[model samples]
Target: MKKDENLKKVAIAAPQLHRHKVKLKIGNWKKHFDFNYVNTIIALALNDFDDKIFFYINGYLITSNNLYLVVQTTEKSAEEMVTKIENQIINLLKTNPQKLKENRSEVSIIADDENLFYAARKPLFKIYPLENDHLIKLITGQKVTLPYFDRDLEHLKNRIRNHPFCSAINYLGGIGPVKVTLFKDQIDPEI
Candidate 1:
């Protein structure tokens, strides 16, 4: 086999995890949350990718519908995917089929492999193991009074800062588990 042909084969055989996080936020609703409309929007966004991508969607109900989505496609850059999705969402909103003229939505790329690396380096929060003394105090019902309380709190804070990585992620939402593929090493051992 020719050297160039061999290289092409190797590249084709390798797994490509081109993961991207897209956040979709819809705002300005006077009445109820329209779950159907949001669902339709998500479906429409994914339609462009067809079967070329693997994706997970997590929806948050705040003042508006906040969707955090992770899409992995072997063939396209994150930017291309985001642009397509943004255009689809904007066009749909412009139609205003629901007659909610005031309603507006925004779609953005939150992270790709590169920036997610930097984000992983930062600690969301840290956990410190409870000391034997603290456990004993809690078990014995020590008086919850000033100096001891203040000292314990300060001590706990110090431990967390000193050993930030001792803590692992407590929860993994929809994107959390699958999106970890973008940075496998960032996954904490404890989790």
Candidate 2:
């Protein structure tokens, strides 16, 4: 089989599949762009876990990750697209058992926007762990605190940055967004 064909097959077989929708109020162009760039980086990194990504944008559902990526700019700006993608990726990493080992994972979103003679960029990164006391507190509606680890955060940032897919997205000037929520189970009304 051809290399591209083989990759296609592998992509189809990967796990971590889910669908998501999001809407955001837009204000500043640069801020929005930075947000989107980070979102894209996170999405690219999630592909490292071999998940089949799907996104719903302006009522349109995109299936193929690659195609979804290509069309990300149609409904939203380049930055917005990146942010959505990263949010999805972080959601996946937080939920997928196979990907979540020792209760920790990290993802980074980088935004690169350049003017005629000047360039500016920023990275938004997130770190998740099984022992995320803050997250637990939020979910459980309780108060809790845990020691923060700078080295661990750095390690996670490096892992996502060095990911093969993330590298490509960054090169394309995409930035990821910081995720506020992770995995959620569907509520069944019939229950």
Candidate 3:
């Protein structure tokens, strides 16, 4: 089956996990705390899913749906942060065994602004293996260019129509400059 098809099955067949939504106010220097907290919460909530939680930080919509859980943080002490994150992850593993057996893939992390200072501070840098090498090469191989919003719209439409999995999306009721949309299908429309 196609990747999208398999993911759709996983979404539909996998047991729905309890989700926690946290809104935290932090000073600029403490921004790192936000990533750490979010990761910890996801890890705790989905402990059975092989203790794997995908993270995304200010991620843009893209065709490749494989790397959905990618995040960037501002913590400087990588060694310490990785240990803590891993410990929380272990706690999740001990809590959920069945889900772990079903989903053992690594979590994806997408950094929102490519902030070098923040990137350097992430604990994942010190612990989890990085898998963005190919993506980095693909990006570096291309000539840097400005984004075309119109072109992106077309690409998004094509992806939504041709994706192999069915998707259910939820979005803010009204239209505005910024909107929030949730996807429960193979391809998230509002990603």
Highest lDDT: give the candidate number.
1
TM-scores of the candidates in the order shown: 0.32, 0.20, 0.24
Write the residue-wise lDDT of candidate 2 on 22-112 in tens digits: 2222222223233434344344443442222343221111111221122212323445445654455445333431211111354333222
List runs of model 3 lying over 4 Å from the truth: 1-56, 59-74, 99-191
The segments of candidate 2 whose C-alpha lies over 4 angstroms from its true place after superposition are 1-69, 72-74, 99-191
Error of 2 at 62 (Å): 16
Q: Which candidate, 1 or 2, would have the higher TM-score against the true structure?
A: 1
Ranking by lDDT: 1, 2, 3
What is the lDDT of every predicted structure here?
0.36, 0.31, 0.30
State which candidate has the highest TM-score: 1
Residue 118, candidate 2: Cα error in Å is: 31
Residue 95's C-alpha lDDT in candidate 3? 46
Candidate 1 is scored at a TM of: 0.32
Give the alpha carbon lDDT tens digit for every residue of 1-191 in model 3.
Answer: 77776664334454333221111221232232334343333335322222243321222112221212222233343343344444554344334322111123443232332342342232322233334332221211211233655575454445533432212111212221111123323242222
- Model 1 lDDT tens row, 67-90: 334445553555565555555655
What CA RMSD would you report for each candidate?
Answer: 15.9, 19.8, 19.1
